[model samples]
Target chain A: MSTRTVDLVDYDDAVRRYDPVLGIEVHVELGTVTKMFCGAEVEFGGEPNTQVTPVSLGLPGALPVVNRTAVESAIKIGLALNCSIAESCRFARKNYFYPDNPKNFQTSQYDEPIAFDGYLDVELEDGTVFRVEIERAHMEEDAGKNTHVGGAGGRISGAEYSLVDYNRAGIPLVEIVTRPIEGVGERAPEIARAYVKTLRDIFRALDVSEARMERGNVRADVNLSLRATPESPLGTRTETKNVNSFRSVERAVRYEVSRQAALLDAGDAVVQETRHWHEDRGVTSSGRVKSDAEDYRYFPEPDLVPVAPARSWVESLRAAQPELPVERRRRLQGEWGYADAEMRDVVNADAIDIIEATVAAGSSPAGARKWWMGELARRAKSAEVELAELPVTPGQVAQLQGLVDSGRINDKLARQALEGVLAGEGDPEQVVVARGLEVVSDDGPLLEAIDAALAAQPDIAEKIRSGNLGPVGAIIGAVMKATRGQADAGRVRELVIERTSA
Target chain B: MSTISRDEVARVAALARIDLRPDELDRLAGELDVIVDSVAQVSAVATPDVPATSHPLPMTNVYREDVPVPALPVADVLAAAPDAQDGRFAVPQILGEE
Candidate 1:
């Protein structure tokens, strides 16, 4: 759209001589029962003040007590990532001043984190598995939430005042950082999204946290840059932050790539800064530039005791690792015989567990897949809810499938019954019974209806008698409509032929 | 350990906003200096073999459930607000004369 596109050859030449390097820092909130260093409840959306304790609120004379469960969870996360757990780790104070953090300084680990030098194997949508190297995974406490009012769109600028909710304060968070990933070039964004998705899968499998992006359980800070050649020093990078979804992450990276490439092609050097991704606009705007680490003065946290996890403790956590996401996905694909598209749909929807449960509840594999991927998915979309949160149980879904399998209900009627179940009317069988929507497979009633329709339309009856069975569908459709969708079409067709021959 | 002065202790406390008593500040400064100097031993022993552990477990890409579950009811969330108006948290006036 600019002059940069006009000089195609020059741009190609620049790209041929350049490479882009990427690094990412992701923060995931663990699903521990208590705060990171206190006994306050680790929950979202409670009565704001009810979740707070003295330690979480940073009350004077209140000392911090580390939650052993949080430490164990962090250790489990580290071990699952194949990191080396430190025998001894000390919490450091990262000093800052903001309304959200009541303590003024965040207690975190510096210079020595809890885990280091790990790697995650992430597979892209195209089936390319890339190993994203992990730099470190450190544990820290979450700050409280801030709501700025009277601003230009409730942001920092023009804000009249800010309010703080300390419920999230002192919550445990594990931040995982990635080393500089090279050679991705154009596929950098996809790789970033895949990496986050893979991480989310791992968390779910481990029962660590409900990594709902909307709830801010998992968030990513994507760093991107452009260079002149693979051997050249990497160009300056811009970090786009708080990208909460895979699609948004991928889009943010691609946007940055084109934006940076255009700037470089126009002879402008890219600025290294933190950028904010506007999901509504699909654009990035500059926020702040961190040129030095001196801004955050790091010191030891004196209020808490130093953590000295025993070697035996680390070993125990490692031994309890759950089945990894990639392996599970592969195994499920083979077991279900789902094509790539079908398998991807399940993975992307995060409906694998629900589908598996339905199958376990006695539904055929294909039938379970169909209902979850089709009707349930559509209902979830229209109602703005997740398939997992649907009111109908897996056993109910299997029962509904049974009705269809035994020719007791057609696909349309099954869908209607499913809707009723989702509306809390009752289970599928109950809905059918209460609404009198059971399939009319009795030949006598079907024959009466067929004879009445034939007597009214003698020409159509003659065509059916002459062996044209296609029009039978029209008659079947009418009969089913008259019966309020309670009649089985196949049995109605069999009765129609018998009446015509007589 | 070298003793810390009252002036230095006051400065750090003001920066950190603890509002400590004069005597307590003096005692804390001394103790902090000793503690910081002692803990600096980590820098000396830390080498390439001593990998820094951030998390104890080998958890690589852990994810949360992607489905958007319902948040706590708005009335419940706002009930804990220090001040509220029209189902939202209210705050004191912050703007000054333009």
Candidate 2:
């Protein structure tokens, strides 16, 4: 538990000295109705130990059968990643002892995976496309949930006992492993985050998993190793286990790089081990060593036969694939006519869906982007919620933009109407009517305000009468203030010039 | 020929969570060597042309539809456990030492 002794070099200094190599393994829980091998119901937050079958419980004489949809989901994930599907694959038993795994062994794939040899190109913050090659994606079952009682912070260490819930056990999971990503000098951390985000988007696009990082549906195990230089041999690596969020994935890589660099500087070898990420403290601590001693003797499971997906079936799945998230982004960017940086900002903010819906609700692309990225984004940040989770809807935003486009209100008044909508004052139109926030379009009242401004500011109006229009703005400002900012400045200027010239 | 060592036998024993005496490890090492020697005879007869087999019957793609089936009753599920608590299975503390 003591990470105090681990010295860390400065991040920039470490990157300047060492080259980082990263390999990521992501596990996504598929949203199937049943478990991977049994017919037990799969639902989140169910009563403990209730969703279990004899096969899941590893009862004697109970046979296991594979769920068909889980395999299809795995295949879809592979196809989306542009991987070649294996003609045949089998499940192998990974033997271990844990309370979470009721079966003493976890049935996973070894040597033969369902999908392999794929690649995903993720765009970084600056729109630099970094291609991460996919090694394979395999199917496995999840372990049970373990609650450590009488421990400090529910940690496994110093616990008096532990409770196991088998409801989560045996749920279908697709584990995607990336090949060794090399030659990423300083953008290693950003690439790590972007890669995971891309995968999350891909999973949701495929409709296989919920792909929500908050719900533990997607988890990443980040493996980092540092070499002296680009041409040097790979250094001893550390695997950070179960980093559940994108920011944490990026942070874990950065921390490990600095920690390993300090170790090398002091002439100490970086121990190859599984490190646990502490989200609160923003550091990683050593967990267990993965030496040659700890071995999971893997062997094929005899209970289940080989899954030889026919060529025709694979072609059908490939044909039924949806347009991937990356391709969809390109199409949307073209349609919206936004520049590279603008599109990148919209994608990074996760505002693409909302902006699309706002566009569908009859707002122009620039109008939708303006309200969401400028005003709504700031509000969401201050309120500590997601932009989509804000009180205002896409329809309401479009309506507010419509009011601005039709000359009924300026941008300032539109913001006030948005504030009213957020305050639960009803829709944009309702808020506009209730607050009387519409622009003073009637020339009768505008002429009155302009005449009053000209009478009050005679010297400034006198300059406009002498053909010096520089004083026209002063009269317009006065009229806008008199109308409580509901009067349009352009319309006020036109009317002020007419009254002063006459 | 003795192919299995005493240390190897002890390692397998510990993995299976079996506490064996020193004398038993020594005796089992010799006995396991004979078992291996007998199993090695089958490999000698297996030609390169013959492929490996995981199951006897030739079958593939054995699957079940993604349908819900009633799980075993919680009481019945807990009945088989040595200790149960609060609708969960309770066990001694695990330090995650490998």
Q: Please tell me which predicted candidate would have the highest lDDT against the true structure.
A: 2
Give the runs in model 2 whose Cα sits over 4 Å from its true position. Answer: A12-17, A229-232, A291-294, A451-484, B71-81, B84-86, B96-98
TM-score of each: 0.81, 0.91
lDDT of 2 by residue, A161-262 (tens): 998888998999999999999988888999999999999999998999988898899999999999999999888889899999999999999999999999
RMSD of 2: 2.8
Residues A99-215, candidate 1, lDDT per residue (tens digit)? 667667888988778899999988988788899899889889988876778867776656777676777888888899888998886577779889988888887788888888889
Alpha-carbon shift of residue A255 in model 2 (angstroms): 2.1
Question: How well does candidate 1 match the true structure in TM-score terms?
Answer: 0.81
What CAPRI class is candidate 1?
incorrect
- DockQ (C-alpha) of model 2? 0.77
Candidate 1 at residue A285, lDDT? 77
